[model samples]
Target: MGNSNQKLQEEKYENVMKKFKLKESLQHTQLGMVRIYNLKDDNNYSIFEFHKTATTSEEAKLMLTHYKNRKCYNNDHLTQIFFISEQHSQILCQDQTQFIIIGEFFYNNIQNEMKNYIQKNNSFPEARLWQITLQIVNACTYLETNGRNHGEIKSKNIYIHPDQSVKLIEYNFIYGSMNGYQKALLLNDFQYLAPELLKEVKAKKSSPNIDFIKGDVFALGLTLLELASLNSCEQYYDWISKEVHTDKIIKANDLLLQKGYSTLFTNLIYQMISDVDIRPRFSDLKEVLSHFENQINNNVDFYSKYQMRQSNQFNIYNSVYTQQYQRPGQINQAQSIYLPNGSY
Candidate 1:
């Protein structure tokens, strides 16, 4: 009876694939080729990613398991995985011996969005940065509540929409970590890794006894710092690579502070990137973020002034410092204006 049921299911899947005509091979991703799925509706278009590597089997199985067991994984912040049939695999010209996993399409990633934003607007706005950070934190909080660590949290893996919302992609790393798959870290991955995690990587420990959640927090802090500084991860990594592990966090904190971010924001970044014993958990970090949010929203005048000063014409000192520069022997020096939170 089970064999007959499996045969029937395979046949159904084959029929569904026949209906999904492949429009074009969009782009090759880390997993496989992303293609445009033409559903025959002129107005409606869908995207499906095809991974044709046998190495992705474990990751594919984990995705399938999540789809079958965890309904909460179907949230908007995550990309939904769709099962691909043998016929679909054949249409995509995938290897017969490989495993194929198809997923929903993402329009663009945060890195691309950041580049575009910087090109057009010079820099990302503080309010928009807060929104993006909050969205990612919410996603991380959801994963944390579900007892899962994201394992990898970087800008490239984060998809962004025009509405300033974000969706996290690439859960294969998380699945690999959870299953003890003995994965090697890529050079790009090192930039976001916590100092302790980097030590484990350097020590060549196959399965290091490190807290994955804390590691993620560290990565999150780095990503947030990158966004806040309007700098790329590669740039930050280039700077930190020259420094020792003990100095990396301090240098990163100093760089963000030098970028003219508020003390509250910079201090939060410091805590997030602190050593494992001192790092703030997602719950505590959420409270800190909420307080900042409330302070921004509750004070309409401050919020308006903040928005107005977002232009390059306004200097950082004008916004953060209360006192103005005094020339030598000046009788009427500019008076200091008190700011919200007392010079934050």
Candidate 2:
């Protein structure tokens, strides 16, 4: 559409190809589909990005630039990587009466970032993984502040940085609770959605008027619970989709009082997903986690922490950060790192 927009897309596409040491595709994405590439260069660029829908490359450029330059994300302090752009003219394919190029795709970094997290710490990892999950709450908070709802807060939509800073991508699904009702609502299922949001759409769906923002709050709760469980197991790899061992959350809270932790933990899980009226907010969770950190570092007995650091656990107690990104000759800088809970 505009010369500047066209140029940005071309540069971003080429930028990624060179970085990943891959050949650029002039034509890909069969009929309305598009191609994505990865680069392995000085500019690792945006980990990977999706092609955006726009009238022209220039329009796409405008959209991408705004997204990349968002000051609210704390991205103002980090180097930027463009994640999307309009499609190529030659690849535009549609009804014979209408031919329009749509968008371009790039191999993104979130997958690789997750891979690294699983890689360096699979057998036994640090609490960093847990900390990153907590950051998602902050991301959701940022969105809420902007009057937007990240309709989908699944783990994959979140991008974890090597710097311990997380940037949330994929606003394609961002909506307000009111908007969610206008369209039949569906929670991004990672099994972490609040029970109300996680209800079977076939049988019951959320009314958009309801404050689905709590879905994000509930997801945070499950994320916290999931991370704590994994850490307690001694090895991160011990847990997986197949390793899910608790479901008492969807059941009644009365079941919790019947047992102890098996119940208390399960009940907390239920509160996160099943009971929206009483669901804990992100602010509430932040307070809880702040206390958790104090408990862990000070060895205080938390009324809620399932445990005060893993017991008889070599992994959680023994792990440390592994430097994942080191430029060829970059000098190391000393700095303290902190999670949302204010712990390093």
Candidate 3:
């Protein structure tokens, strides 16, 4: 009976996948197999497929309940969800169940963005940092308000648009409830985990004792630090594994300052990566970001000066500029500020 059911589920999943025209094999991420597919309507979408061992029918029901009617996906900073497997078809198997997720296709992620910056020996300005901070904080806050926590928040999980806007991606819904697969995956990516989370894992705790929302805050701080320093998290594996000590944090903070980032911005990164109890809530971070935004609005000349420096460093001879490094801080007092696209 179990074998028959497993075979049936596989057939159903294959039939559904056959409907879409497979474009290219993108990459095998920690989440699952990500591929580009074209719908019958000729629209391209990224499909995320993962398989987990099927223990019971309850698992599928829980997944469907969570994926369906999720209001968090509507936020602009989050990767929008277009389709979920259980909504379209009942895809469950006795041995392994397959989950398919279709969402908007983004061209670049923060990880690759960092690589580009590093290759060019460029660093993010304070204005650019504020833009990313505001958007990511809003995304996290929305998820928290909707009663969800993105257990993994890292550079790779963040997509970057040509305008320098970012969207947090690859939210594993099975993180807290169904722990077998996601828990194992997160444990493997330990550099991004908060200190409290690391302590719990080291003690082999069954569930989290600390708020996962605060954990997301810590990860966000580290991500900002990486962007500010033009360094990847992998480069700071030793420091991150040690719970982000003052020495390493100070080094990164000092690097940002040397690159002309304000002390206020660097200081917030410290407070964020600090111990869980010392960490400020997302609201607190937003308050700081608002202050930073005000500073940007009031200091248009200062921001434009930084942009000029950036442009000069990039190319003085070329008449046209690449989309990635195009001037984002060229706002005037008469124009709306905060984001290049006029989004707050």
Ranking by lDDT: 3, 1, 2
What would the per-residue lDDT of candidate 1 be over residues 72-141, giving only the tens digit for each residue? 3655676666664322123256423233445555557777867887778665555666666666776777
How does each model score on lDDT?
Answer: 0.55, 0.40, 0.59
Give the poorly placed runs of model 1, Cα more than 4 Å off: 1-23, 26-30, 38-45, 51-67, 70-72, 82-102, 173-191, 235-260, 290-344
Top-lDDT candidate index? 3
Q: Can you write out model 2's per-residue Cα lDDT over 282-317, one digit (the tens) per residue?
A: 555555555445433453322233322233212322
Judge candidate 3 at residue 315 and give its lDDT: 26
True-structure lDDT of candidate 1:
0.55
Tell me model 2's lDDT, rounded to 2 decimals: 0.40
**Leading candidate by TM-score:** 3
User: Against the hidden reference, what TM-scores do the models get?
Assistant: 0.66, 0.48, 0.67
Report the Cα lDDT for candidate 3.
0.59
What does the lDDT read for residue 336 in candidate 1? 12
> For model 1, where is the 10-residue window of minimal lDDT?
327-336
